[model samples]
Target: MSRRAEHDVRDLVERARAGEARAVARLISLVEDASPLLREVMAALAPHTGNAQVVGITGSPGVGKSTSTNALVTQLRRAGKRVGVLAVDPSSPFSGGALLGDRVRMQDHALDAGVYIRSMASRGHLGGLAWSTPQALRVLDAAGCDVILVETVGVGQSEVEIAGLADTTMVLLAPGMGDGIQAAKAGILEIGDLYVVNKADRDGADQVRRDLRSMLALATGRDGAWKPPIIKTVAQTGEGVDEVVDKLAEHHAWLASSGELERRRTRRARGEIEAIAVTALREKWGDVHGRSELDTLAAAVAAGDADPYGAADELLAAFTD
Candidate 1:
């Protein structure tokens, strides 16, 4: 990198570490845009990361996820912790940008300097997150957030991906959402570290809680495994939010004492490294739009002149060369 560019990145990192929201936002934008300077940016911020506790909140649509996240942020701030929120929203087809629905709902924190909220477009990536999310998270972690909440694009069944990314995954369910059945089908039964039945004042809330507890009972775990707790809350009214925060702290403590925190973060890092390497390889092979070595190998395979394995070998050989 140029000396000027390196200095610029250093300046941004310093400002972000000092809790400047604009600097933090700029760093995340660089990640989202896949800027050429990303490597330098990541290096600059590396030492300052690994401090924030990441919490991922996910659920089916209309489960009041935004409301719950807003409440959670409110509670966290009341405790004097710096919080960062990454709200993954569906991409707007016209503009290829976030719809800003989560940001809109989270307006309660707009004036708070200690809370930084960003809405990211899913951008057609599957598993309920933007491709840039992990990098954006590093930016937040390096920005000195004490706790970071990732709220996914409520894509239903495939939303369980949050489990792999967070230190604690909180799954939200609501009465009248048929979530009990959907939870089983979506594999959320295994992913959630804590489950919240939002809209707890509704008529069917008790039934929803019972169903969730029974389903959780059926899942077997090793000795000393943390039993996922079910908490009921009316997120709009901030009811029962303190208990949720308390549970989060309890879980974080368990993670540290049990050494699972290191394991989880290591796994997260491995995934991030593998993704970066794979992306680099794809870039080396060149884009699909142009006639590249991959296109040639694919053509040979299609014509039955070269088997897929052999073509793949050739591609790897070329890549290695």
Candidate 2:
């Protein structure tokens, strides 16, 4: 990296550590853009990471995810915790930028110095999260956030991806949103650490909670499994949100006692490392996509002169050798 670029990163890191929001924002922007300086940035931030409690909130659109996130921020802040929110929005087809609807919904904390909120575009990456989320999360962690909430785009089954990244995953549902069946179909039953029925003041709220409990009971849980708690909330009024925070605290204690906290962090780190390595390999492979050796191997496979497995081996050999 150029000397000037290195100095920029150092300045950003220092400012972010001092709780400067704009510097923190710029560091995350570099991560979102996958800048060439990302390696240096991560190295600088590594020592300060692993402190924030990551909470992932996901649900189908209109299930009040943003409202719940906003409420959670309020609750956590009242407890004197610094909070960070990453609201993943679907990318615009033409601009590849976040639609910014999530940001609009979360304006309640817009002026709070203790809270940092960012909207990230999914950029067409599946699994409801932006490919850049974990990296962006590192920025927040290093910026001294006590709690980081990741609100996903809530795009069906792929939304379960959050379970792998967060320390605790909260799945939100509503009374009239077909939430019970939708939860089952989206595989959320397996991923949720806490099941929240938002808009609980509405009709059929009890039915939604009952359905969730029924489904969870029938689901075969592993030995010593952590049974997800069901919480009801009218996020618009912040009703029942304190209970949710209590449940989160209880879950965090349980995770630490059961040694699951360390295990989960280890697994998350493994996935992040593997993803980075795979991306590097893809970049290398992209340069050789139309190489003569690859074309010849493709022709051989097409002609039945060699099987797909054999062609794949040959292609890999070319890349290695």
Candidate 2: tens digits of C-alpha lDDT, residues 187-272: 77788889999999999999999999999899887426688999999999999999999988888888888989899888888877
Off by over 4 Å in 2: 90-95, 101-103, 124-131, 154-157, 222-225, 289-308
What are the lDDT scores of the predictions, listed in order? 0.83, 0.82
* Candidate 1: tens digits of C-alpha lDDT, residues 225-245: 799999999999999999999
Instruction: List TM-score per model, in order.
Output: 0.92, 0.90
| Sequence-dependent TM-score of model 1 | 0.92
Span of 10 residues, lowest total lDDT, candidate 1: 122-131
RMSD of 2: 2.8
Scored by Cα lDDT, where does model 2 land?
0.82
